[model samples]
Target: MILFVSGCASTYSTRSVEPSGFLGDYSQMRAGAEEDVQLIYVNPQADFGRYRKIMMDPVSVYVTPDSYLRKVPKEQLSMLVNELDAAIKTQLTPHYEFVHEPQAGAMRLRIAITEAQGANVALDTVSTVVPVGLAISAARRAVFGTHSSIGKAGIEMEILDAETGQRLWAMVDERAGRKITGKFDKFSKWRTTHDASEYWADLVKERLESLQAEHAASTP
Candidate 1:
């Protein structure tokens, strides 16, 4: 399973360009730059706060046909999907009602895991790298370039009007695994899949909350 650092939040910026006709029907608005940690596009006129219900589709693994994950056992993939779906539900439950199916006036959240790299935990432990220093170095490297050593995870999601199928928002983000530090040796460790899941889930929740607040304030 892939591992990722905890508290690794993605930074996002919004663009006001017209949606490119690239992603088929869902490309009403497209995000800028392929390398951004979080690329978000929002309909400038949409009132996000007005949507109180959401229908989340099952999380899908969209890796390449011949990707390394294809060789992984089926049970492992299922476990990852289950964890991702549960994490999303847990994060959104506090802010909106969940529906079993799409309905009028509701929003639909579609999510997919586009890429994942599993960590070699045994290798990480035996490797002579200093945990704290390596983590700090990794953070610095992230600002300059992509560094995928232990593992990584990538995700894409879209929010649309359930009835009209109008794209309201969309984002893509990815995070890399990092070494962990602590007061004692027991707690100082490498990142894990659970840590990655929590970080991404919390990032999504925070972004949604910010959008909701912005819309709420703008309403007359």
Candidate 2:
């Protein structure tokens, strides 16, 4: 039992790009990034009623040993996307249109479930290095109501200029939900006891608003 609990207290880390000066590997990605842009329109959630999905599977890779990684099924992605879309739409509408490809015409916002992990990593160590600084994902069948939650809902959005194919802005967030343990037993789908999407959204919006203010401050 001690070993089992100790094993559960494991820790893992992973890193992903947060854009930068350019987007793609091609030469044009640099020059395309300098264009004067406008919001034109915004979709808090884009498709699938606001949440979009990519074919790439969600991966659980260990940043430590750096070898063990398993692909999460597309079904999980699909289910999570739908749940996230509904959650976001409850606050805001679809941010933009899906013109087929990113290079179709207007700016495209693609949301991919980059990462969705819910395993309990046992760690009494102070420096476990959580990528999102949050606990594991789990199911909690109560909070919002008495209904049972299937699993957690996580979403990551990348806004790219379709013409340039450059990712300008992006945000990754996860929310806690619950799955029915039995007939109605509920538990936190995440290791932590809070939905992180709201916090992340506010953080992103704060940065965006600050940048907007800076741009305005620098203008006239």
Candidate 3:
């Protein structure tokens, strides 16, 4: 039986994904600079250099188009969210102070896991949680720069001013796992999701630093 994974979300597809409506507004978003799988927007008037702390909300599951992710077990979803949270925190902790409440110089970040592809046949049979690893297939790498048989994940994120609740940045993106040459098919169903979350977290840091540099240059 063919189980539907993430409701037709595909890493190889050139067509853009439709919004999951988790961000509420998509009017300002445009294609991301580094990849085809991203749609992003930044508030030009927002001052990135002023923020030194961040309040990150727990990652959530928000499947769209009604019921696409129902086939995935609730525990699996929980694991996925936890993995994302860990990955993002690991990436951002060095650069920013994580806080629990809104405070001066703090930005609020919210993220949601909107979609994830189902596991391959082997993974489907396993009853317990699988160990996560990012090993990709050679054939898939040559064709799509993605892992074969392994699943992909999609997410939506937004950053806001902690004080005023004004949105500063937003992004929606999806990704598949990377290829590991020589080491093959040591796969985990959630590895791509974990990798994608880390990538997004790094992007957040990169974007903020760029804005900070620009802000510093323009300061009198």
Candidate 4:
């Protein structure tokens, strides 16, 4: 019975990436939506309609032994986190008021970048080692959603009640860049990470909207 239940549950750690222990716990996470790439969990008691503000914590990078991003230069890692923060803020700012201190109606958000891998290790290292980052082409961004070889990245995030410590929602997702090579082959190692951050931010906003809708529908 235990094995059967375990088989039915979604696995957070995968061959391409593993949980960096940044989330602290992964026991409640399960298959998210119909997508295999996402693992998520939401507290049943969470009422999204009650929150009108968000407290976004600084984005963090996992540097433990299991992290693929550990070897990345500090500057590159900082860039990744900053880009992710900007992406998320852009998505959420329109829907919720941004707050610094914990208040009555707010949710605190936290994110951790777990993996960032480029297609060629030598080239990847060189790109980061140098001061100037590689320039990514618009064509590469279009192809990034399809074939994957140029790069890949992963992230984990959680939302918690601002006043209380209870977790409201959490998610883990990963994405890979395309294999297409040509004039666009030489791209930034953080390109996929940037794309994934945008995707996650969009999803988080959509999920919050849906949660609010659900509460509204059930209220009346």
Question: Number of the top candidate by TM-score?
Answer: 3
lDDT of 1 by residue, 164-216 (tens): 88888776665555444331232222243445566668766776677788888
Better of 1 and 3 by lDDT: 3
Per-residue lDDT of candidate 2, residues 1-220 (tens digit): 0001111111111112222212123222221111111111232232222223212122222121221113445565455455544433333333333345444435454444433454332331111234222232211122232112223333445555565654545544333332212222223333321233333333333434444455556555
List the lowest-lDDT window of 10 residues for candidate 4.
1-10
The list of candidate 2 runs beyond 4 A from truth reads 1-75, 87-107, 119-156, 170-186, 190-194
Q: Model 3 — which ten-residue stretch has the worst lDDT?
A: 1-10
Q: Estimate candidate 3's alpha-carbon lDDT, on a 0 to 1 scale.
A: 0.70
Task: Single out the weakest 10-residue window by summed lDDT for candidate 2.
Answer: 1-10
Provide the TM-score for each candidate, comma-separated. Answer: 0.73, 0.38, 0.77, 0.76
Q: Where does model 4 exceed 4 Å of error?
A: 1-17, 34-37, 121-148, 180-186
All candidates' lDDT scores?
0.61, 0.32, 0.70, 0.69
Provide backbone clash counts, one per model. Answer: 0, 26, 0, 1
Q: Over all chains combined, what TM-score does candidate 4 have?
A: 0.76
Q: Which stretches in model 3 have alpha-carbon errors above 4 Å? A: 1-14, 34-37, 66-68, 121-148, 178-185
Residue 86 miss distance in model 4 (angstroms):
0.2
Clashing pairs in 4: 147-178
Q: What's the ranking of the predictions by lDDT, best on top?
A: 3, 4, 1, 2
State the displacement of the C-alpha of residue 111, model 3, in Å, after optimal TM-score superposition.
Answer: 0.2
> Which order, best to worst by TM-score?
3, 4, 1, 2
Q: After superposition, how far is residue 11 of candidate 4 from its true place, in Å?
A: 20
- Candidate 4's displacement at residue 33, Å, is 3.5
